[model samples]
Target chain A: MPHPPVHSPTILCTVDVVLLTLTADGLQVALLVRDRAPHAGALALPGGFVRPTEDSGTRDAAARMLREKTGLHSPYLEQLATFSGPDRDPRGWSVSVVYYALVPPMAPDDGAPAAVEWHPVDRLPPLPFDHAEIVRQALARVRSKSQYSSLPVHLCGERFTLPQLKLVYEAVLGERVNQVSFRRRMDELGMLEPMVGETVGGAHRPAQVWRVKEAFRGELSLSERVLAGRD
Target chain B: MPHPPVHSPTILCTVDVVLLTLTADGLQVALLVRDRAPHAGALALPGGFVRPTEDSGTRDAAARMLREKTGLHSPYLEQLATFSGPDRDPRGWSVSVVYYALVPPMAPDDGAPAAVEWHPVDRLPPLPFDHAEIVRQALARVRSKSQYSSLPVHLCGERFTLPQLKLVYEAVLGERVNQVSFRRRMDELGMLEPMVGETVGGAHRPAQVWRVKEAFRGELSLSERVLAGRD
Candidate 1:
C-alpha cells in the first residue's frame, strides 16, 4: 500500500461480505472464527482488509475475500451498506463496506478457509463485534428486494423447474405465493429462459427446467406489482 | 483525526451530501465552489472530511456537514452509496460515503457557506472531479425511488393541496400523472394527513391542504404503481 506524507490523514478501510445460500433447512450465512484481535475466536462474517494497491472497488475486495474465506464463487452480490464509526472498531477510525452475496446450493469446498462454517441465519450464534447486526440488515434487504426482484433465483440450481424456483422465492419471502400470479409476474420480468432439452424429474411427471437469463443474473428485475406490501 | 502506528493502514474518509430541494424551475442541488487543492475554484457538492473524534456515524457526519456548510437541517436523509477507489482522490486512497437528503421548498439560505450556490439539477454546469458523476447517480436513485416511495413529497410546501403535491411529483418524475389515480395511490400509501383547518384557493374552488404524516416523513411509503414509467 502507498503511504501518505509524514503528516497524513487515513482511516482503516475493510470490506465484509455476508455470503448467503439456501440450505436444506433454510437460509444460511457463511461465517468464520476470527484468529486475530478485536474479537479473536468469535464467529463473524467472512471479511478482510481491502488492499488499496490491488482493489479498484469495494465489490472486488468483497469477491476476493469470499473466494478466499469460503471457497465459493457467488453469482449475485450487491452492496448492503457501509458500517463506519469511531467505536465500531477497537482500533481507530474504521469503515467496513458491507455486501450481501448469494449462490446456489453446493457441498462445502475442500479449499475453504479453516474455522469457516455455514449457520442458519435465524439461528446464528452470537457473533463478534457488530457482525450480528450486519446479518440482520442483510436479511432485511434480501427479503425486501425479493418482493419485486429475481434475487431468490440465485439460491436455485443452475437449471431449475418452476416449482423449485417458486419454493426458493417463498422461502425468502416467508409466504405462500399463488402459482398463477407468480408465473405471470415471472413472465413480465422476462428474466427466465427455458432450457429446451432439459427437464427435472419427479414421481408424477418431468417438469421443464429453466435458468435465469444471463443479463438478469447479476441485476435486479423490477416488478409492476407490490408482491408482499399494501398495493 | 487520529493516526495509527507508523505502518498501520489508512485511507482518506469523507462524507459528501447530495442536498436536493424543489425549485420553481425544477429540482436543485446545493454545490459550493472549491477553494482548496486537487480541484481548486471548481463547483463541487457540499461536503467535508469526516472527523474521527467528533463523528460516530457517517450519517451524523453528513448531517453535521450539511448543517455547517449549507445552513439547512434536512429532515429526511439516507445513505446513498459509497464512492471509493485509488483514483478518486489524487492525493491518496479515499472513500467517500455519499448521502442524499431532502428539504421542503424555501429560499436559498443567507447563512450558506461562502461560494455556495443552488444549481438547477437538470441544467447543472460542469462540476469538478467526479462530483458530476455523483450528481448523476443521485438523480437516478431519486427518480427510481420516487416511483414507489413517498420521496418527492419533500419537494412540496409544509401545507400543500392535492393538486400542488401532484405537480411536485410530476415534475420530479418528468411526466404527467392522472389526478384520480395519483390521489388513489397517495391514499393507499397512507403517508398524508389532511389538515382540517387549511385550504389553498386557486383559479378552481379551494382545495383541502395536506401534510405528510409525521410517521411517514422519515420512512418510505411504498406503492404498486410506477410514478413515471408506463402505466
Candidate 2:
C-alpha cells in the first residue's frame, strides 16, 4: 500500500442539523419529512448532501439547509458531532456531520415544503436513520454548554424579560433554576444589555427586556460559576 | 430538487487525529511526516482516508491510526470536530473528521516507519493542511472539559499520587492549580479510587497512589464546581 488507492470507495457525505428553538411549550426541534425512499416520509433533520463544488464548509452547507427548510438562519450554530457508522445509513458508508442550530421563535414556513415542522425536543416522533442519537447528542451539548456559556440566549427573541430567559434555561436544562442566583450570575456574565424602551406586561408587573450584548452574539462566551449550585 | 441526485459529488473523506500524551517535559502531541506529494515530508497529524469498508466509525478509524502510528490505543479518544473547507485539501473538497486521543505515559515506537515523534504542544512546528487549527480546537476542548470533567486523569499513569494528578491538570490547563481545592474537587467528582497497598515514596512521606474509578475509566465524568476558582 505504498501508493494510496485513487479509486477509494466514494462514500456519501452529508450534513444533518438539529435546529432547536424555544416555544411556549418547550424547546422544539425543527424537522423535515424525507420525501424519497429508504425512509420516505420519516421526519429527519433539515439537511442535505454537502455539495462538493459549492459548499465552502459543512457549516455553510448546514446553514444553507437550515435556511431552505425553516426560513431562518441560526445565530448560534456549532458542530455537535460527526456520526459515521457502517450500519447507520442504508446507502453505503455515509458520514453525516451533525450540527445544532439555535434560533429565536419563528414561523417554520419555507413555503412549498409544508413538511417542515417543529416538534418538541422531549417528545420527538420516530426519526429516520441515526437522527434520534444525533438529537440526543445535540441536546447534551446544548445543556452542558448552557451551564457556563451564554448559549441559551440564542433561543430567546430579540428582547426578553429575565423571567422569560429563565423559562428558556429551565426548558433546556430540565430543572428549575434559582431566580436570584441565575440573575446574579447573568449580571456577572455581562452578556446581556437592557432594552431601554422595551417592557412586557406580565401578571405581576412590567418587566424590562434584555438582549444579548453584541460582543457575545456572534460566538459563544463563557462565564465562571454561572450555574454554581445547579451543576 | 425534490428528488436527490444519485451522482452526488465524490467528496474525499479522511480522518486526522491529535494524539496527546504526557512526556517527561510536559504534554506533547504525536505527528507524522507525509510520504506522498503535495507536502511530502512535512509534519502532519497521524491520519489517513477512511477505508469505507473496514472502518465501523470515524472514531474506530482514528483509533486504528493511533495504534498504527504510535503503537498504543488511546483510552480517551473523542471526536473533536469536523474541519472541512474548500481550500483545506489540494486534491478536492475534503472533509477531515478530526479527533483527539489521550493516553497515559507510553513509548511511541512504531518500528521502521519511525516518522512519528512527540512534540511539545505549545511549540509545534508548521503542520500540513488544516491540522494546526484542529490541534488548537482539540487543545481548547481538552482544557475546557478538564475544568469540569475527569479528562486529565487519563493523561496520568495508571497509578499516580494527588500531586502527580495536579501536575497533569496544570500541564493541560497551562496554569498552576491550588492543591487543596484540586483535591477537594477530585474527592467530590468521585472518579478516583485509592489502591489499598500502593504508595509512592516522596521526600516528605509516602503518598497514596490512586487510579481512576472503574466505573469512570472509559468515559468522562463531570463534577459540579470542579475548578471553583481556577476558571
Fnat per predicted structure, each in turn: 0.48, 0.64
Q: How many backbone clashes does candidate 2 have?
A: 0
Candidate 1 residues A109-170, lDDT tens each? 64666567889988999987688999999999999888887888888877889998888988
The TM-score values for the models, in the order shown, are: 0.93, 0.92
Tens-digit lDDT track for model 2 on A93-181? 88999888888877535342566688998899988889998999899889988987778998887788999888888888888888888
**DockQ-derived CAPRI band for the predicted complex in model 2:** medium
- Name the top lDDT candidate: 2
Question: B72, model 1: CA deviation in Å?
Answer: 1.2
lDDT of candidate 1 at residue A66, scale 0 to 100: 81
Model 1 Cα displacement at B218 (Å)?
A: 3.2
Q: Report, to 2 decimal places, the DockQ of model 1.
A: 0.49
Per-residue lDDT tens digits for candidate 2, residues B1-231, read 243535768788999988888877888898888887668889889898898778998999988887777666555888888999778888778899988888876653534246668889889999888888888889988988898878998898788999999888888887888888898889888889999988989768989999988888889888767573564
